[model samples]
Target: MLGHPWAATELGPLPTWDPAVRAATDLVLASPVPMALTLGDELLLLYNDAYAELIGDKHPAALGRPAAEVFGEVWSMPGVGDVIEHAYRTGEPFLEKEATLPIHRRADVAEQSVFTRGSCAVRDSAGRVVGVLTVAAEITQVTRQLQSLGDFAAALAGTLTLDDVARVALRYALTVFDADRVSFAVDEGGGGWRMVRRVRGELMDEADERLPPLWRRGPADWPAPAVEAARRGGASYVDDGEPLRGIAVDRHDQKVRALAAVPLRAAAVRGGITVGHHDPHSWSAADRALLAASAELIGQAAERARRFETQHGTAQLLQRSMLPEHLPDLPRLRIAARYDPGVDGNAAGGDFYDAFQLPTGELGIVLGDVAGHDVQAAARMGQVRAALRALALNDPRPDQVLAGLDRLVTSLGAEGATHELFVTVVFGVIDADRSQVTLASAGHPAPLVRRCAPDGQARATYVDVPAGAPLGLGSRPVTRTVPFHPGDTLLLFSDGVVERRQQGLDRGLATLAEAVAGAHSGDPRALCAAATAAVPGATEDDVAVLAVEHALRPSRSASMEVPAEPTAPSRVRHWLTGQLTEWQVPETVVGAAVLCTSELTTNALLHAGTAARVEIDLSPERLLVSVADSGTRGTVTRARTDTLSSRGRGLGLIEDLTDAWGTDPTVRGSTVWFEILLPAG
Candidate 1:
């Protein structure tokens, strides 16, 4: 600058260099660090060799030029020019830490450089501010690295799944290190690993065979450096030569020049992450350290996700196995059942349902929930369900069944088999013959009965059954019989259906009743589904539902008694035909009914040797004929037809001609009944 031609043309001659300018120049030239002196009103630029190198390609031409013209790209940056002007004007030094300057040092290429800028005002002998002497120490690499790690940490904290961890790790690694490609691999235990790779922000398809294998071998098969680093749970960098061969580099189009692998260690599993670059570059200690830290975070997240999934799966399986595989085919009833686990932990709660046949020909339906949500509660639920099924075989009463279950639960608690476990259950027995349902509640919500009024509008109301303390609380439960008329439905559900976090149980129950009344169909399955749908939000507890609907009853014609003798079949058949004719039963169905009545009466007299009574029922859709006898061994069983034989076709003939036939034991003997559909008019 002292002998440059531009200095003579732009600012005339040098001022024999003033005292302040000369002193600043001497000080800047003597310093080994990057320094620059801007002198006079024009702020002419003078920079040391180190400062010239910091400016990149703008060295020689920038000498002897004005500060604004030389550093024009960053002169207007926030507080840049103002700080320099303040020091020059007020003679008060200023220091700014980590100031950003956007510089175009390379032609057509702009870059942001972070620096610590310190400016001191040079004074004349008279103490007047002369020029600003500024020093800049560039820290762009260190600042950018820290910012990248901060971003990675922020994104890593919100990840909940293994895939989420992989995606976030790859995205941040590429951005932070400015790498061309990044790939993450998780060890699949037994010497196998699954890998996901992304190149320049594009994820490669797993099915693409062109992509090299990620887990064909274990870590021991890799190069010594990578294997040793993994053994020590650290990070290692492999250059673009022999070490690259041990790693998969099947990106045929782009040759990998460098690679760095970091071991991800967690309590459950261990994995590896690798970042690649196309240019052969050395990785600094800070870069390797950042990669290691990111790998550790990912490993921790993967372990948590794995543990949750495993627990959720096991809980779901256990809960499902405890529920009924299918509802029983109860006479004159349609049944539907459902179960849903809580949403908070995705773990199964103690809610369960069961439908089984009692010895008395009644269908027993049970819905219950244990107090807690865990393996122990689920196990206890299974034990209670099994006990209830066994008890129902001997005792068909709802109150008796619940009483036994309560005792069983108390026994379990007393034996240290359970810990403070309380249970709520509603046991019900449906008697289709009597058109009634008896239910017993053990601290459970009352069952709901839905029916259509004469006006064809649906109405839903809860049974006013007396309450009892939950099982394990030692309260005797009372059984209440509700008039389950034809076309009425009985709905039993867990509290999860009507219990919301923000609402009381009463309000939820009211909402459920309203939903049931507004249902589009009266079918049991449809009603149960609608009730579950009516829940306000995500359920905090498991839900179990059981619905039973009694269909319309058939009209009855008076029953006839016949003497138990050789002539009883003919007598019963004559009486049945006459009754059917008076009831306007179709001719085609009447003939079949008479024949079935004769066959059933003859069989009963021959098998039990007792008197028999015949009854007929007619509906707009069908006809029912029942024959009761004072025989203990009388059971309706269809005989297999032998094409060559003719004598064993009585029961076979009846089965072929009728729609359905079954036998139910009476107090004295058994009643064999057969139904035939009436012909359409």
Candidate 2:
């Protein structure tokens, strides 16, 4: 008041002050608590040294200013100005405890302050109110501590994994308590503890060499002061004055000067937490309480995550055991298969696929689904797959295989199987050489056929096949034969591909067909991947898909008849050579083709004593030649021979020159065939 020139201009000099204000000033200066006085209608401000420190940088200039000008930010708060006016008007006292207000203390930002304010009217000689005397104490730190606790509780509620819980607890501890490093350790149940440590918000691995050796110590060892405190289940602090030989060091290679440790407790597990500082410091009760609360939350989350992982692992094992270990390799066809369980990781579903060779030398493909998604469903699927494989080995026809499966399912039901156990399967046999597919559906979706038309454009269309009752109902399945030429593909899938919630089967089928038509690659793997990627939403059920594509190759075949005489071999060789020349087969392959054809033709006519028919097939990679005659010969074994023996050398010579050779018995004749790989152009 004596030094500021504004004090003289803004209000009258100290000698000319009001009697009430002079008396209030004398009382404020004598008090040890914060005190301020505003006198008259202008509400001029006057405060002692204790109150001056509370007002921060505005102290000296605010001494003689009006209350509205000095405390403008806080004047409009809920009860601030009103309480002062009420006290001055009625000569009564007003009090508020822990009242919140936005006070401008520093120049850069306005801080939220909680205060206890008591205001009373200052009276003159006639007992009339002249000014207001207010005393205030700030409690902002206490209010912020309570708020931090609430926020930490809410943040820990939504974490689902152990790692997520650890990260959240460490982050809040560093931010709320203003600590430099946070570490969490959980008991691993065998005298071991798994620890996660973070320094300045970055997680550090146990293998990180930059960390102190104390971090890598075992659970039974408590040489470090922090670990001993956690083991004893109370808060403890370590400083540079304590033992520092085994403790961890900071980035500066100095022992951690200050550290606090707390124990974590939950229903199922026990753990610990440690917080450290770079410089020497003291531990406050508030800091210990916050760390202990965070540790408890982390313990609870770890227990829940452990249970989830156990269930997920069991479900995965069951599903994988029921699926095929490997797919079959077919001769002119490519196959791709995939199976995906339900999105919920704990429940195993019943979708499966199988590709294997049948007794008739044809490819048997099966895609099926049982009507549930549980452990029992998975077990039933395995049984169904085993039965299908056993039945397919005897019968290669699709309808016959399904009929056998229906009988097996009926027998199982009679033997006390559940009525809810039902299966829908699409069984098909692919004859790559004949370019034909025989498919049968047992209450399953029809397979899709993607064909390259004569104009060289690809299009997809679903096979029109009749569906019968599913397996457990004992209905006979109907079979259909579809033409599958080179550059064509066949797709068989479970209902998950074409059956979605709130959508019709026809709509999903159309979507799948469109995706297949737009695919540029005819490779089975590529086509299957593209089709699955085009599905619109999350799959509600398990998915299983099997795709097969017949590759295109430059091929030609010719057949002719030869007389049952000595001239038959010579005439057949000449005819085969001429045909190969006409087909533009290379000269190098024509000679070998004629030689193999002559040897087989001569043997067929002489041994069977009948006229022979010659069939030759030329592909880009190999040549297949077959000679058929009227005989039912069973074995076509090669006879051993020496250089001097000419009678048993025909079969041996043929075997040596051909890549592969076999014989098949027809209704009235036996046909011998050999394959020789053509030379690369």
Candidate 3:
């Protein structure tokens, strides 16, 4: 209901009703006491019998016409529309402090006179606001008393902050006439006026800060001449804050005057004030330069701060997307990364760590910190990570591997004209064969390895990866190795973890070592989390961590049988037929394999670059037919991609005919592979 366009205000959970709703509406329209109205996007004037005698107009006939149509510019009052919306927004009855409406009294006289007005919002089911109701009286005497207050109570009701009120006033002020800039400055105490808020002259996403400085705090930071002049001035100053207060106004085209500064106060003391004036002209009290309204200007500043906080919350959410929940399996190692951005409402820094299975089934682990923060840093982090993965797959030798990355970064920076990122990266490839972890750094932190004790306490051991330069700016490739036997855990982190603003790098490393040594659990991921939690949310920068714990080599099952006859395509085909007959397999498998085997075998002989043999491992889970040749070329093109017209069906048939298929290009050659789903017998 709150989301409904017709309903105003934030949605409330329950029904809210005035105990005498209908009766109140009736009494509101009745007599000398009845100063009432109804709104339909515009106001309609009404007068009671006794009041009608004073105005000399028929009541019912005057109902439909607007006060403006009847009275012209004489009835124009700024902020009247907002006064109505405020009533709807707050769901409250309002008596405008001091406001005037010009309306006709006698049909013979044919002229509009002044009167005062009031209103309240109407609401509907679901406790949602629907419209506004009003009771406006013609109080000429009341208007004089209100001369001090200006029907502002109703106009400013829904506003919780001074900035909000100023914005409301400025909007009305701007609508009535075009202005170059509208600003609200607040008085702190003795002699300072802080420029708390301003609506951009015109909203431009790419607003440049290269122009003359816009002051945010007080006169101390203001332009030199203005600072001196404002020091001696009262609570407010118009365009004369600098010039007219101490010099002639002829220096500029904008002659400053009528630049009324209203002294704002809760009781007696001057708070601050809002000052306004036309650029090519002088200002006046009615010129919307009412400085006495500084209280509302202060309110506007608080609103801006609240808005900043909301946007800050949103940016934090966007940053969360960089962290992954699970790391892909790398045969002998378990890995995870924890990115603690540290504090809320803070900028997102460039701290990234990623570990995923490489094409070789090896775990490619990377930790790097690009300089700076926000979306740009995280996005750059992504670019470096993706490039690292691609480079590792092409050719991986720690120093050589990272050197390749340096070339990539250099090219990317040159192409994009990227800023020189003073980054450091540590790259490690955990061998799938449990041989060891090859460690390399482009000047990143040395990875920490800890042996998890039976009691959950881990003894920290830092791996010996050679020192090298960071990437981008410049770096010599460096490499080292760590034998990652089944149980050791490796920890990778960014500077945010242990590096304090004043602390030395060595002390930071030692602190990390202590934290890891104290943590229980063989899970490298858990230890990474424990160390991060120990610091709380006080980090000023970003912390990216990668924890890798190798998996114990699991025993796998294998079966083999020798058949008489040669392992030629014909013999293999016959063997499959014979095996299917024995197993009572269906005819479909019998048929699909006839062409699948013939083309596979023929291709092996014709294009398979080496003498690598053909092996078929059939099981209930799958039927794996692999002709692993020394063939480093060609891919398992899908049937859709195959115009291998006459004989090209080898791959086409595999895709159209098999469930899943792929090729694992290795150091030896590419193994174009495929899988066939086997029917349960």
lDDT of 1 by residue, 568-609 (tens): 888887777887888788788888888878888887777666
Candidate with maximal TM-score: 2
Model 3 residue 232 lDDT?
38
Per-residue CA lDDT of model 3 for 1-681, tens digit only, reads 112232232222214424343343345446465444333334444334544454455555544345445444443556455565677667777665546554456554554334555677665444555556655555564333244334444455544333345555555433333443344444445555555323325331211111111334554444322233234344444544332344332333133332333333333222333333434345444343333343444344444444544564345444545544346744455555566554442456677777767677777788888776667666777677777777877876667778877887777788878767666888888885765888888877788887755674558878877658778756787678767766677888887887776667687778778877775444544566556654433667777787887544431122223222235667657766766566555678766755575566665555442454455544443455555555433333334433444334456666687665554322233344445656655
Error of 2 at 399 (Å): 3.2
lDDT of 1 at 407: 89
What is the Cα root-mean-square deviation between model 1 and the actual structure? 20.3
Model 3 weakest lDDT span, ten residues long: 204-213
After TM-score superposition, the amount by which residue 40's alpha carbon in candidate 3 deviates from its true location, in angstroms, is 70
| Candidates ranked by TM-score | 2, 1, 3
Better of 2 and 3 by lDDT: 2
Evaluate all candidate structures by whole-model CA lDDT and list the values in order.
Answer: 0.74, 0.73, 0.54
Q: What does candidate 2 score on TM?
A: 0.61
Model 3 whole-model lDDT (C-alpha atoms): 0.54
All candidates: CA RMSD (Å): 20.3, 21.3, 25.4
Scored against the true structure, residue 228 in model 3 reaches a CA lDDT of 35
